[model samples]
Target: MFLRIFNRCASTATASRPTSFTFPQRLNRSPTAILESLNSCVQTDGGNPAYIFMDDPFLIPTSGHEKRQLALSKAS
Candidate 1:
């Protein structure tokens, strides 16, 4: 349901563009706009813990060992 609505909105937004932008140009310009749109959507839904953590990194584990493990896994 959310994906359907998101797809519709994305298609509508892309269809209305008047410029002949390439795919790469569109991709580069999309992140900020997409983030703003997602933020608004999630805000309305009262945001889940996962999304909340993504925006505020400090909410993640603070223990030195845990941080080191996470960093090591991410590096690989």
Candidate 2:
């Protein structure tokens, strides 16, 4: 059902000449590995474990409620 709607909308937006897209190789392209490579970029303030999270346990967010609250607070 969603695909039909998407195709209808996309058909109108598409050009007369259809273009082909070739995706990049994905052998070792794991999402976790990609994020792990970014660990060195995180700023460490005084080498504190909770420094990045402002020392708030709620900010660590193990549940949906905590996650939403943290997201809303940051958005404000």
Number of the top-ranking candidate, with TM-score as the measure? 2
Candidate 1, residues 1-74: lDDT per residue as tens digits?
99999999999999998886656543555648888887878744453333323534764645667666666666
For model 1, give the 10-residue run with minimal summed lDDT: 44-53
Q: lDDT per residue, candidate 2, 1-76, as tens digits?
A: 9999999988888856569878888586676876777886776576443333455765586666766786778779
lDDT of 1 at 57: 71
* Count of residue pairs whose backbone atoms collide, per candidate: 0, 0
Cα RMSD, each candidate: 15.9, 14.9
Task: Compute each candidate's TM-score over C-alphas.
Answer: 0.25, 0.30
